[model samples]
Target: MKKLIRLFVFFLMFFIPASRVCAFSDGDSVIKIIYKRSYNNPPFPESTNNQYIIIDGNKSYCLFGEGVRGKDGKIGARVDLMKDFGNHTLYFMGPMIPEYTVNDYWSDSLPAMHWTIVNQFTTIKNNYCQKAVTNFRGREYTAFFALNIPIQDGPWKFCGLPGLIVKLGDSKGIYNFEMTSFEKVPNEYNLGIGKENGDYSLYKPLFKKWHLRRLEKDKARREADPNCLDCGEGVTVRYTFIENLLD
Candidate 1:
């Protein structure tokens, strides 16, 4: 009997495909919102990306719709944002090196928004939403919030409104976020992560400026390497980010 149990354990450990292994930690979310972001960076056509925000009370986790792993079985160059509104901290993982390293985690204070409520209303997903505007991190944003939900949260650290932000966009038309789906997930639905760890130990918190500098260094390295797969020959690179903070 012991021998058979040992064989079963061995098979379970070694025979299962790595992809089948779940990377999400044991945390559950009550509400999940999917946002479609459309944006354009100069030299490249406007592209659309999808992100998921799972909210459980005063905390939420955000990640790309698809998994963060690359074809080469390495962590891709992506940023995952997690907000702990209870603590007033916004945690972000990355500036990861595609097919390379998973960088350290850095955090900054949750963005403070001074919102001006407008006397405008529209219906979205069966909920009546009101218009509000605010300037966040250098971009003027217009948001529509649904008072019915009563959750003080929204996609990508856009919170503190009277309710959930159903739609958000910047003034330049460079970035727009529209919620595609909102579902009340089961309690068992894992929030994916309680802390930042990418196949490695939980990363210690670092300064945001340090992380930004590392990102710049990584960008320079790729530009210098002519054979870089991410940036091919004659491709004019334009560096643009969602957050344009004045130094």
Candidate 2:
């Protein structure tokens, strides 16, 4: 038994697949929202991308995207989504420190988005989606929110609104988000991590304090590791928003 255990440990250290940090586990109660975003330009927003946002009242929310990976095969400037309700902060990980840029949709005064509910109603998922518009960078962007859900969250970091955003699109068609489906996920905890290390404790208090250290180790490992040939050329990375308004 001792020999077998040693062999298993050796195999995991060298032969196991690269590590990925899915901090939160999926729950059966997920409000899945689909979105289609485009830059309407070439080699920039690159191409039209289909993304999904998964939210659970019991767990943290996550946005799935075809993000750019670094040479180490770890996500760089363009990160897969991570939202921590315990800390109430959003972190956008990239290759280097992210240099926030501005486009037609975002501006210097982006932290304070003035949203006005127009009271226009539309049917979505057999529920009413109320229309609301916010002017940013001198452009009027419209979003449809379902107030019945009573959840103040949306795709990416576009939360704090009165309700769940069902559809978000700019007048010029620069970017668009729309809901597609909803389902439930198990509220189970997942501990499998770090080359066969045992289960992790993700309780709110313990996790919040330990997460920063774990993140530092992750960053160091990614930086020290060599490039992954399998990663290939990455998609062009760009962002208009990186930080939260309250932070």
Candidate 3:
């Protein structure tokens, strides 16, 4: 498997058609939450990335609002992270390289976040929210959840709360996610990946163990290549992965 992945890394110029991965079609998206995500990846602080979370009946999909925005300002079909609370499963898809157009995905059981709801209270976007804390993956997080939302989920692997998390930030203050807007979709939305008729068999399944391994290889490549254009002279390079790679 490692050899296969290494081959893909080097020979990725050869096109592999992406598979059409479908989202739950049983229900329409009831609500969508837009989050203003800010994080520090070292060498850079307070980096901003917008994220969106769409809630269906018993499933939710969270994805970056990068390539999925249409010219009409509506969301296009794309799925980055999907949570199926009913099945206790999660599907993580990412690193959408335009050259390969290969849909890379991985699946694992939902993480068990033992959140402790606190007595403290606050309001976010006019919603009454309460404080909750939990140790997820490797970081301790303080989250503010909206009681009125009545959804047990949030941005980026935060769930098991009594309501939707309105704001989340790690203890180190390196990462912060806050809900900016919430709205109900006027029509049905199907979260999907790749073209409609694309071959699902071509989708690559990435194992969790290989994630760090791949990163290390890329790091070595970058370090050895003095001509790497991403880094200029005197520019300091550092990496701070959002989640513990080991987890």
Candidate 4:
């Protein structure tokens, strides 16, 4: 009985988390996701401020921007969407660093309005701009701007779209993100305030803290071995904002 009980408890613990992670409901609206960048690259050496917007029916949600500059001097941006509703949490999935340039600074201003591929490839009548693209690991990507929608904006310097950004990333596979699915949320989405004039600024300090922490950890590892080839290197970065916005 004791052994049986222990085995049952173990199975329960293992399956519970796994089930929660994998159990996704069907019939929920599905948004196609594509990472236009590479995979696993750094976040600096590309553009700085990034932003995004999402429009559902007539309602829209905007997330502030966030930026990443890895130890290797690679830069990338991140935009948040509504919280995860089902089994999947909203996430970026492309290269995180830049591939070509060394220092391409983006503007703090927003983008023009435009439609996404998902939005039928139609124009939304806003000012959209191209940000930057960088190679990371080995892939390539481009970032863009969508400025018509005002409600959706987030951390980093990511912004300028009609609806919020549904996808973003670079070519080298460093950083990538997309909205897989979303449900009607009740609370009013608010853009917090700070360095960038909103909650997105919070990620600035957080990125700094994490970057420094990683640097220290990597430095120690190098000290112990002295021959880590991947220790430090800068790469190119790029950004693109799809004109159609969705599809």
Query: Against the true structure, whose lDDT is highest?
Result: 3
Model 3 per-residue lDDT at 246: 40
Using TM-score as the measure, which candidate wins? 3
Ranking by TM-score: 3, 1, 2, 4
- Please provide, for model 2 over 25-132, each residue's C-alpha lDDT reduced to its tens digit, 9 standing for 90 to 100: 333333445666554543454456666555544323344453344566533222244444445544432212122211101111112357888968776775456788
Give all candidate RMSDs, comma-separated. 16.1, 20.0, 16.2, 19.1
For each candidate, the alpha-carbon lDDT, in order, equals 0.65, 0.47, 0.67, 0.34
Model 3 misplaced regions, further than 4 Å: 1-29, 41-43, 66-75, 94-102, 193-233
Q: What digit string (tens of lDDT, one per residue) describes model 4 on residues 8-105?
A: 85455445434322222222222112222223434445333323343332222234432345565533333333322222222222111332121211
Residue 29 Cα positional deviation in candidate 3, in Å, after optimal superposition? 5.3
Give the clash count for model 1.
1
TM-score of each: 0.65, 0.48, 0.70, 0.27
Off by over 4 Å in 4: 1-39, 42-156, 188-247
120-191: candidate 3 lDDT, tens digit per residue: 987777676789998876889999987666667788777888777889999998899998977765334546
